[model samples]
Target: MEPLPSLEVIKLDEAPLAFTLATLFEPSSVLSQKLVPQLHEKLKSSPSPPTSYGELIGLAIDQVRTWNVDLQAKFISGHPRIGETKNLSMLSAKEQGANSDRPTVQPTPPKVLARLAHLNAYYERCYPKLVYIVFVNGRSRAEIVRVLEDHLGLAHSLSIDEPALETADPVDVGSQKWLDELERAVRDVGLIAKSRLIALNVA
Candidate 1:
């Protein structure tokens, strides 16, 4: 939970930059391969490096916006699924109540819970190596199912005649609701957690 060194320091020191990126992403993730170089370049060229953790978060997610599928999928895979029993990060545990101490938190309905789990697995099959990212934001299970089905249906309809746009940038990819939602989830999940780290002076 150490706060990152100043962006100026990280800009000049490769070791610090790499460590900072590791704090934000899984070790050996595409973030190191795809995003860190770009961020490093920006840091060197810009008249000012990020002065605050919030600015750093913005820079990181902007790099995220440009990533192709392989990188994005790798980034997405780091997150634990909502309500999942394991692999939850500090942020996910707090946001999704994955590690709540409260005993009164109601369990999901049996059938609906099963369906949600099914959809998560089905999504992985549809886009191999990619986990579906959804901004849970306290939504109910039924609502999450609708969001999942809606995105999956959009992807299915678009790929009816051809394979989906595997390489297209999520933001620039043609009118795809599924991709849009996925990208937003990616941004939100990371931003919220990173911002929390910033506020607490944690790296």
Candidate 2:
């Protein structure tokens, strides 16, 4: 459907599905490389096609869950740390707005920014298997920092607590939102293993 508005997604329709799947994943990312084919096959064979971009993302989430734990950890590793700007994928920089260190959409207090940095480091140490994933939405800098703090407490839970979207030449809203939500979902789900590890006192 019209090239899916520049989110780098191909329409789920049959005609171009194969062509699109070929490039959906970054070649360097094993998780994406592994999943793209499976996703294409799953959608191609389904009795009913995905109704929306979000549904396609939901399928992706389900697919990620079925992967081996080692691969799941590898998936989360692909994400950049919060506020990280340099070396971002084009989509990432656009979505995060100047990266975490220097946001222009809304400025955050230096203290809060510092706290976020601390959590990024601390969280990685606690649960090296997963990266922190907050949807950002359109929250003010303060709000974004608040969620980062909240996630700190839930480190053991890997739970997603609300407050979570996307444009053509710009990204279509649906595809971008799907990208945001699905990645967060993957990270959240990936944390399940770490929580288990912690519970068993193995982490």
Provide the overall lDDT of each model, using Cα atoms, as 2-decimal numbers.
Answer: 0.61, 0.48
C-alpha RMSD values across all candidates: 7.2, 14.8
**How many times do residue backbones clash in model 2?**
5
Q: Considering every candidate listed, which one attains the maximal lDDT?
A: 1
Clashes of 1: 1
Choose the strongest candidate by TM-score: 1
Tens digits of per-residue lDDT for model 2, 94-150: 445534333232344566555556656555544434556655544444455667656
Q: After superposition, how far is residue 193 of candidate 2 from its true place, in Å?
A: 22
**Candidate 2 residue pairs that clash:** 83-100, 167-170, 167-171, 167-172, 168-171
Error of 1 at 127 (Å): 5.7
Q: For every model shown, what is its TM-score relative to the native structure?
A: 0.63, 0.56
Model 1 lDDT per residue over 1-203, tens place:
56666767888866788777666544455666767778888888888788766677788778877877556767777666644645544545444542234312336666656666666766665655567676555565556666776766643221222223353233333336557655776776576547455334564
